[model samples]
Structure formats: C-alpha cells, structure tokens
Target: MSSTTTSITCTGLTFGWPDGTPVLDGLDLSVGPGRTGLIGLNGTGKSTLLKLIAGELTPLGGAVRVTGELGHLPQNLTLDTSLRVDEALGVADARAALHAIEAGDAAEEHFTAIGDDWDVEERARATLDQLGLVGVGLDRTVGEVSGGESVLLRLAALLLARPDVLLLDEPTNDLDREARQRLYAAVSAWPGVLVVVSHDRELLGLVDRIADLRPDGVHWYGGNLDAYEEAVAAEQEAAERMVRVAEADVKRQRRELTESQSKLAKRVRYGNKMSANKREPKIVMNQRKRDAQVSGAKHRLLHEQRLEDAKERLDEAAEAVRDDAEIRVDLPFTAVPPGRRVLTLRDVELRCGARATLDVHGPERIALLGRNGSGKSTLLRTIAGGLPAVAGEVETHVPVRSLPQRLDVLDDDLSLVENVARLAPEATNNRVRAQLARFLFKGARADRTVGTLSGGERFRATLAAVMLAEPAPQLLMLDEPTNNLDMASVRQLVAALGSYEGALIVAGHDVPFLRDIGVTRWLRLDGELNPVDPEEV
Candidate 1:
C-alpha cells in the first residue's frame, strides 16, 4: 500500500458475530477515491462492513488493505467530559509543546511533539468554526457542549488529522439543518476516499456512487441515491414483468398437461373397446395398446417438465422483488375530536433558556425546528411533565406521551410484548400481542428481549409502548424520532404515524419526514418559540 495514493480494499472477507451469526462471507470490495454512500436495510451489515474496513473489527477469514491514513467517526460518539475543546480536537499536546519552546525550554522532545504544526490551536479553532461551532470556545469542557456539538467536534478532530480516507457512520444523526449543511459543504469539497454509512437521504445525495450491501454481496450503483433509486425501480419493474410472464407460462403448461391427459384417457378407452370387440388380432391389439401407453407417458412427462421449469423461473423472478414490509397502524382510541383543546403553553421558560407560549388544538401536527442546542427537547419535556418550567403555566386536557430521542422508556430485559403490557396494563395479553403485530413484531419477534433488538427494532418497541398506553395518548410528542433509523424504518414510522389521530409535536431536523407525516404547523425554538413557514427553513 502506497501512502501517496488513497483507496480501500477487502478480499475474501468473512465475519460473524460471537453467536455465530454470519454477516459477510467470502466478500470482495474495492472502493477508490471519491464519496461512496454505503446503504441498505437495517441488519444488512452496512455498519459492520465499514467497521471492518476501518480496523475497528477484524475479519475472521480474510484481509483488509488500505493505501493511506484513515479517519472514522462512528455512529455513537463518546468524549471525556473533563477534556477541553482543544484537547478533544487532538491539538492540546502540540499547543503545550509550542508553549514550552516559546518559554525558552529548548527541549528536543517539545520540538518533536510540535513538529511543523506550531499553529495547531488556530487550525483547530478554524476547523471547529467550519462546522458551525463558533460559539464553542477552545477552553470549554466537553460536558459543557451539546450532544450535537460533540458530534461536530469529533468531526473537527478528524479534519485536523487530515486523513486520506474518511469513514463516517450516520454522521448526521444529531445535526440540525444548519449543522448538516455545513457538514455537507465539507463532504462536497473533500478530495479523498470518503465512504459514509447513513440513512440521511440528503447526505447520501452528496455521494458520487452508491454501495448497496445485500445478502448476496455489494452491488454498486454508478451515481447518487436518487440515481440508485431510479435504477432499482427500473430493475424491479422488469423483474415483475418477467414474473407475470412466467406465471402465464406456468398456467399454459398446466392447461396443456390437463389436455394431454384427457386425450390419453380417451385413446385408452377407445383402444380397450376395440380390443374387447376383437376389431384386430389379439397380438396386434396388445402391441398397439403398449405403444399407446408409452406415448401417453412421454407426453405427460414433457408437459410436467415444462410446468416445473416455468414455476422455477417464476420463483427466481419473484426473488428479485423486495418484500420490505411497512407497519400497520390502527389507533382509533387515540383520536382527538376537532375543536378540542389538546395542550397550552403560557410564557413557559425551558431548561435551555428558551421560552414558549402556544395552544395546540384537535389533531394539529406541529414541527419543532431549531438549532442543535436551541431547547426544542426541553420544551417537549416540560409539556410532557418530565421537566418543570421555570416560569409560566403548562396544561394538557388529554392523556399525553412523549418518545424521547434516547428511547430509554423500555426495560432492556423485557420483551416487546411485556413492555407493551406494562404500558397498557388493562389490555389483555392477546390484545397486546395483536397490537404488537401491527408494529411488525409478530410471533417470536414479539418475544425477543429489548436488549437484543437492533436500533430500528428497539425504536419500534419504544414507539409501541408509548402509543399503546392504557389511557391512549391523545397528544403524542416525539423528539428526533428518525435519528437512528434506516430508510425502511423511517418509512415504517411514517406509515405508523399515518393512522394516529392525536395532536402531534415532533422535534427534529428531518424536514422531509415532518412533511411526509403531514405537519400542519411549523415552529422554531431559538430563545423564543415562533411560527415559521415550512419553506423558509
């Protein structure tokens, strides 16, 4: 591997979990310089493959080769709370070395630590400012920054390192609209091998190619996500057409087999009658009867073979079509009548120094838009009674439930069924199981413990617990609901929300998702809550 070039290669890669669940087996991949969006449904090993390439995970039976320095920003980010911002950006040691040299220490080790990077602090601050972190100071501790800011800070460290190859797993999970745009600018201008594993459609649209990880292997699409989607749609259409043709062929073959059998039966009856009437000599009649029997057998076998071949073709064609199921939601019990007062906020002060005052009526859907630390989540928590307001009044006329971004509402040891039962105590076990099925947890899936579920699966379980509560929440609030979900799971969430007739307050940066859920009101939380048009954001 040459340091001058940038690339990633995996040959004969095979990996499995400790439980012996195979993910990638005998796989081969080559990613060259450019942005590549690695995408697939949940549990398809998109994240696993990225981890393997980034050396976070070792393959069981293969090798991974990289040509240049690499940097990786994982989905779940953790930073030491006591570390200063400059330390978190990986410039503290260099800054210390520079200071020692300036103080006339004349130490060889300080020079070695500083290297040619004497202005490390300036570069680190510049990187932070590039990612919309101007307000975050160099001396501020990691604990003082918001979660979204922490994500950007990690990215800033990666930028300062200036690796030739970059890997980001769900990089925009916590970014607000403004922060995401800044990150997008960085991705667009990146001049190296950049591979991102994400479900953010806007982020994926910035890639030069699409790497779709499936059960078979990696399928490469020549362009961005939109192009990939178009190619897939065209392929599916052709596959469905072939399936229809194969089905018709099967039907035709079955008809021919039936017709052939009927003809053979008639011929046998005629021959038997002739023999009985002695129309020909006994030896001749016997010979004719044997010949007819052999012919009929050959005809029957040929038709059966044709039908079998057609059915096989049909099965193959059907396999090409995806069967990603959507959630089935029917929550008549959660509906709020028109003109009903659902919630009211009067001069309420939030934990993040934001104030709000509003009245939510009927089944109005509101989108709470804001920057990373603008107090959107705080306002929702105050309304849900999870947090107390510093000033003013908050009231709700109906049962309310809030699904926070952390999704910590469920007990890890409990199964989906048990968790739903805990929430909806009055509902029978049978009834709860039936509702769980609507959330796409059927049979044994419903019995799987929450701890063992994937990110998407756990989200569904949490959503079920809240939506299926005993009194049936007429007012439902969600904080960053689409943060960790795959595209399929996002769609499933939209489908589930389609059936909810309650007043909704959703806080997040996913405007497309908000639009898909039919949000009627758009509000921004930036020190003060105010209404805004959807297009302006």
Candidate 2:
C-alpha cells in the first residue's frame, strides 16, 4: 500500500458458504489500479470474491486487504423508495432546507445562512449533466424508471461517491446500446482500480486485463478475452499430456501386477504338490517355503498396492481442466412462406403518444437498429402481439414469438417452472421439469422466483418456454436477446439463429452479434418512432 496507488493482496484465501463446498480454496489475488475484467462460467466464485474484497464477507482462512473505499453494483439493486435522485448525491438535504425557507418556515438567520433551492438545483443539474442524465427530472423516482434506466441512476450515484475501487457485476446486462457505450466511456476514463464481472465481449476488449476464475483457482492474463482464450487453449493442450502419461504408467503397473500374481500362484502350486507328497525334513522343501512366504508374498503385496496407487493417480490426472462437454446446438430451420410476402407492414405504425416507428418488410431478415428510446421495442412488440398494431396490418402466416428486450412477457413473481407451466398447460409436471433441465435450469433453479432471476437467467428461461411449443414460430422476433448473456452464450445463441430457417427480425446494436446471427437486412429508426431512410439516422 502506498499514497499513489491502492492494491489488494490476498494469500491463501479459502471461503465458502456454510454446508456448501469450498468455492475459493487457498486462492491468491493481487489487484492494483486499472480495469480488470472477470469472466467465468456461471456458479464460479466471481460474486463471492467481489463480496470478499468489499469486506461484506470474510475469508475463512486467509485475510483480505482493501486499501481504500470500494463501491460495488450487484446485479440486483434495491433503493429506498423515499430517496430522490438528487438525495443520492447529497444535494437533497440542502434543497429541502431551501424549500422550507421559501415556504416561510426557515429561521431568518438559518435561511440567510443556507443556500436556496435554486442553488441546490443548479448543482444537482450539473452533476446529472455529467452523467448524461441532465434532461431527466431529479424528482423522478427510481421505481418509476425501467431496469436499464435505474441501473444508470445507480451508476451515477456510485460515481459521485468517488470511491477508490469500483466493482460492477453484470453492469451492462440491462443496458441498451447507448447506455452500454456510456458505461464503457465511464470505465475507460476512470483513474481508480476497477473490477468488472461481466461477459460482454465488447466491454472485455476495452479492459487492461482479463482474469478467469476456474474451479481450482484464478488465472490472469495481460490481454482481452480473445488472447485469454488462445492462452487457455494452449494450457489445456499441455494439461491433457499429464493424463496420457498417467494412463501409460497405470497400464504398465497393471501388467506388472498380473505377472506378480501369476508367479505367486505358481509358488502356491509347487508348495501344495510338495506337501501332498509328505516330504519330511527336506532342506530344499524348507527353502522353497521361505521363497514363497518371504520373497513372493511381499513382492506380490507391494506390486498390487502400486497398481492401485497408479490407478488413483491416473484418475486424478484426468480430472476436469476444461468444460468442453457443453451442449452444441445449431438450429437449421426456417419459416419463409412460399409466397412473395413472408411478413408485411402496410402502414404498420407503433405509437407512444404522438411518436411512431414503422416497418415494411418482405421475406427477408431485418435488423431494427436505434437508440433505446427510438421506439425499436415498440415496433417489435406490435409485431409479436404484445402491443396492438396502432393503425396498420401486420400480415404473417407463421406464428411469431417475441423475446422482448425486458422479457416482460413472463411474470417476474412466478418461478421458472410455474411460468413454463402456464406457457404449456398440456405438458405434465415431470415433462416440464425435464424440459427445464435442457435450458440449464435444474431442480431448485427452476423453482426460484423469476423475480429473483438475473437478466441472463430470465432470457434463458424465456427462450426455453417459447421454443418448447409444438408448432415452431415461423417468425422469430428478438429484441436484444444477447444483451444480458455472456459472450459464450451469445455465440451459442447466435449460431443457433444463424442456422434458423425462419424469418428473423432483431433489434440490436451489437454489430458483430448481428452479423454472426445472420442479419440479412438492417433498418434504423428515429426518436419520433417514424420510419427513417436506411442511410439516415
């Protein structure tokens, strides 16, 4: 620790929940100032390590040292209902006092001593402006905003706190294109130590380092996701060699064991034959007895023990160092009708008040691209039956199922199993359980309330429910399906979509993701919700 820099150096840290297996075992980490992206498969100890560094949880064996103030944004954030946006930044108290003075309740001396509401409002506005939220009213309640907006609100508050270390877990999961860019800008400009637990490839590319958490321990590399992936591949190849060597050794030991057993059997046969002849006081017979008991017996026992030990060692060497047994899915199916019109929008208008965004498409894939408020979602909702077509006909033969950006179609209060039950009432409970397992939701996870699920989990559960129906939707409408998913999941989902035979209408700004998922067309919208020319924003 020094005045110029803050660092966390932990050695032999071992921690886990009560009654649960160890998540981090004798782990070591030395993190200093700079952005470090944390990536791992689900159930890894990323969140736990965040809690430990923040001092919310203690290490079971070793100590954790944090040099300065740290601010963390967990996936789920709950704020006090009564607190306003400005109150989060310490300007509300001053504004409240000034408001009282204007109402003639403030003491004359105190009123003159304290600043007025107008002054407080100016300061709050400046702070909000820095966060690109100046246009929004400071009085707006957190509960009134969408999850994406609330996330920014919390980030603003945290940024204003001026902590030395900032940890954000899945921070961009709920953010749209614009907000995600804003987050990237914030981290890129930050001068403090930052650890982000995220699966966003775009975000990962901007980080100074990438650290992967495995079951055994953590490994840090001085590059982004791509470089880490390459290094990991090399390491795995090397690790696999250990298994081959151990296997070879085990085989040799087993052969030796068999030979020793045969030799002992021959000795027993010879001894039994000599005893049957009733040889008495024969020196040769006595010598043969000593050979069988002292030499052959001891050698047989030792060789047998060696073989067992060799087998165990082989098993240990073959233990998992890579999780490559994951499912491989490539959905090669389409729903393009034989006719000229796969889908249509004749005066297809979607409106929120006086604004609208419209689309007219043939039997082709189209990307609806725009800022979050540009009414991209509204257009998709109208097509998927979530919202009525305000003043147009959306003709389509194939069934359309939408993966809304917010995934609001599913009730947040219900568990995944319950939601799936509602979606497919004809299916039995056992059938539903088995179906859920396909989407990686097993047992208790399927029973956990949807409200408690993260954005990624909700998306996975929703996809499982939608695709389980008998008649596949000829048209798939996805609004930012990859927003909350990790990079690997995104790739998997994209690969599936690429092979999809059905018509696709996706609203997302992930350029590479769109390309990977087979975007055959692209459409951009404006803030007025009206159709803008493809070239013009």
Candidate 3:
C-alpha cells in the first residue's frame, strides 16, 4: 500500500504475435502508485501490454522492470470446478496449517508453513466480504458459486496476496448491478499501483488517470474517461482549425505563383518587343533576355518552395485530427406499428424451467437484467426459436433474429457478403454488398473472410448479417451484446440500435449502455421473468 515508489516500467519494449503481426514496437511506459485506466479500441494491444508487464508473455525485445510483487486478473478467468474457495484464494494450506497447530500438532512443517502469516484466514474472509461475497464460505467449492462470484473471488485472492501492483482486464464484464458496485468500491480503495484495462465507463470513471494506447504508443491523459474525451475533443477542434488555415495558405500560395508567372511572361514579351523595335545591340538583347529568364526562374522557385512548405504543414495538421468512422444505416422495413403484436409468450416454459406469459407489442425495447447463469441467455434463445421450450408455446408474429454472445451466426470461412447473402437468400449479391458497406465493411473489406476480422469488426459483421436478413427481422434478441467490445464498438452498436425500429430484447449486465440505448422496459430474470423498475436494475 506504499505510494512512494514506481511499480512498473517498460523501456524500449517491443512484441508481436507468432504470425509476425506487430503490436507494440519499442513502446515505453512507466507507472506509479494509484489507479490508471488503460483504454483503446479492440486490437490496440491494451491486454497485450498488461500481459507483458505481468510476465505472462515475454517481449521480443527491450526490458520490463517491476519494483515489487504483482498480481493479475485476466479477462477470461477459468478455475478448476473441484477447487475449493480457500484453494482459489491461495490460503488453503495456511488455513490448514493454522488449524493443525491449534489442534496440538507440533509438526515443524506446519509451523514453517504458518510462518509470519498466522492471520491469513481472517484476511481472506475480510477481503471476500469486502467484495460482497458475504455468504460464500472459504470451504465452498468453485462450482457452487456463480460466474460473477467467481470473478470477485479471484479478485479477493489477489487482494489477499497484497501485492504492490495489480492488473485487471475487463473485471466487470459479467457482473450485475450490485456486484459492479462492490467492484467500484474496491477500485476506489485500491492503494497500490493498479492498472486496469476495461471498457466499462463507470469503472473507468474511478481511475485517477487514463492511458490511451495507440499504434504509435501510449498517450497519457489527466483524469477519467469524461475528462479525456473533453480534452481530445478540444484538441480535435483546434487541429481542424489549423488544417483549414493551412489549406487556405496553400491555395493562396498557388494563386500567387500562377499570377506571378503570368506577369513575368507578359513582361518578357514586352521587353522583347521593345528591344526588337529599338534595334538594340544583339549582346544587349541577349543579356536582357538572360536576366529576365533568371529572374523568372528564381521567382518560380521561391513560390514552389512556399507551396511545398504549406502542404507539409497541412499534412501535419491533418494528422492531428481523429477521423474514426461510425456506423449509420436506415432500416425502414424493420419498423412496426405501435399497436401490432410482435411476440407472445403463452405460458412459455424456459429451458431453465421458468414459466412466463407476456405479450410484446410494437417496438418495445426491453433490457434484461440478471446475474451470471441466471438463464437470461436461455430465455433469449428460446424466444428466438434457437432452443426448444421445455413446455408451453412461444409465438412470433414477425421475423425474429438473435445475436448471441459468441457471435457464431456467421461462418468463419465465408466473407461478410456471403454471410449476409446466406441469411437473406432473396437479396442479390450486389444488394447485400451495398448493405454491408453501410455497416462499414466497404468493397474489399466485405470480401475478407470473417476469420481475418478483428473482434470489433466481427461483431459489426454479425450485427449486419442479423439486421439485414430477409423479411427484415422485426424482432431482435441480443445476449450480452457488449461483452468483450471496446468502447468505440459499443458506441457504434448503440448508434446502430438507436436507428433500429424493431422490438428489441437485449440481455446484458451493462447498465449504462442499456440506459443509453433507450430501453422502454426493464425486466429481471431470476427464477421467472418479471418487470422491474429501471432504477432497481
């Protein structure tokens, strides 16, 4: 918990994947005590940088230096189902040793194991409780807890270790509202050198600073996400102004060069005419012509150099501006009348044995909230007709499409156009290509195999395929739509869904994102589907 020392530093760091795709090249960074939020678009090496710092990955070049012990929580956490909570917390041995010593065992090994950490069990329990794991006993097995609980449990283990530095990657991806609050509290209280890579806006808001990773390197910004955005916006505005001024300067230089050339030519013609009319000596005429030619050449060179300088300035100004593209589309056919019935659940029994009867009218946007393994996804699949209901009936009055969390709707071997064409068999290839372009996969990008696309690109492609299907799906169901997406892609998804006029049933734990997308109704799925207030969620 000391705050006076540097925790992590990388000097001339470089790394690349096995396929020779360069990620970080000669990158340098240093971190001190307090929390720093690491953010960037998908495939920008945010996670990769964390791994390098944690020594989980060895850099191809340069060196990483850590001042103290470090602990890391990966994005995709997996634990043995048979592992006990104490074992996962890394305190099982110490706890057993302490109990054995108390039971009158004089074994030197137990004493040695207990060492100076005689209060390990108490610390572990306190850490777990701090993370909102009140009822989860240390003796409980990993399989007895939910996925969100597992995440917090792992974090508890790291906290118990009391390392001087910590790294967390997307720690709140599957956490519900209450669990997220617990995480926010933990982050706010962390006193060590903490660097977290996340797209969760609320989580990022707790950080003391932001580290934006780019192709060139990492750029530091003061304050949290909102401050960083405001600063960047102001910078972009100034850059644009500079570009405009540079452009005008270039235009003026070009015009002046053209006018000067015209005047020089006219003067040369007049001088020649006067010299010939006056019948001057041949040597004098030749000297005058040579002088005129030299003067014209010098004038042209000066103007051309000025024009080149202006162009270079313009190029630099343009580079300062960020021009990231956004997805914009119009799906008029997907709209439905307010009074039209879109879906009906007649005593429908979910795959998890939950029964619910409900009617969805028009384009009602519903936000499904639940903890991990609460069957939010199961209900969505059942409604989408991807899964058979255990009992009762699910009736859909319009075309339904589901975008699963796994994004398995598209074939990896096929191109984006081909995938969309497969979903909409009636649409011609040209039409499909045109629609795909609207999703930001223009021309050749649409032809690239899905396997070649990045995580964000794949999500966009999957969304495009589902939304562009034939009959124009009037009912769309999405499961954990924001999982693993970068902030930019999340914004793009929100924008795209904003334009969607279809009935939406999105199951996700991202509360801020759900609110931003304008959810008309909020429903919580526990043992049954029931309406809940947005504030409760």
Best by lDDT: 1
Cα lDDT of model 1 by residue, 396-477, tens digit: 9999999998889999888788889888889999999998998888998798778766567778889988988979999999
Best by TM-score: 1
Off by over 4 Å in 2: 1-32, 45-68, 76-90, 95-150, 174-178, 216-218, 222-227, 258-290, 293-304, 328-342, 353-365, 408-419, 428-434, 441-455, 495-501, 527-537
All models: lDDT? 0.90, 0.72, 0.88
lDDT of 3 by residue, 92-140 (tens): 9999999999999989999898899988988998988888899999999
Evaluated against the true structure, the overall lDDT of model 2 is: 0.72
Ranking by TM-score: 1, 3, 2
For each candidate in turn, the TM-score is 0.94, 0.75, 0.89
Off by over 4 Å in 3: 98-106, 275-279, 330-333, 351-353, 406-437, 441-458, 468-472, 534-537
Considering lDDT, where higher is better, how would the candidates rank from best to worst? 1, 3, 2
**What is the overall TM-score of model 3 with all chains considered together?**
0.89
Task: Summarize candidate 2's per-residue lDDT along 1-537 as a digit string, tens digits.
Answer: 354564777788888755344568898888888889988765567777888888878889887887888888876566765667776655666666677777888576545545443576675676566656655677876555555666777788777667888999878765777788888888889888889988777788888889888777787898877888888888778668878887898899989989988888888897878877977557778877887788887897898888888888877777835643232233334446445355666656676432343443334677777765566777778777778866767766666778886577688778788888887788899988887876778787788777655456677778877765535566788887776566666765765565566777888767677777666666776644344344442
Off by over 4 Å in 1: 1-6, 19-22, 426-429
Going through the candidates in order, what is the number of backbone clashes in each? 0, 8, 0
Q: Which run of 10 residues does model 2 get worst, by summed lDDT?
A: 324-333
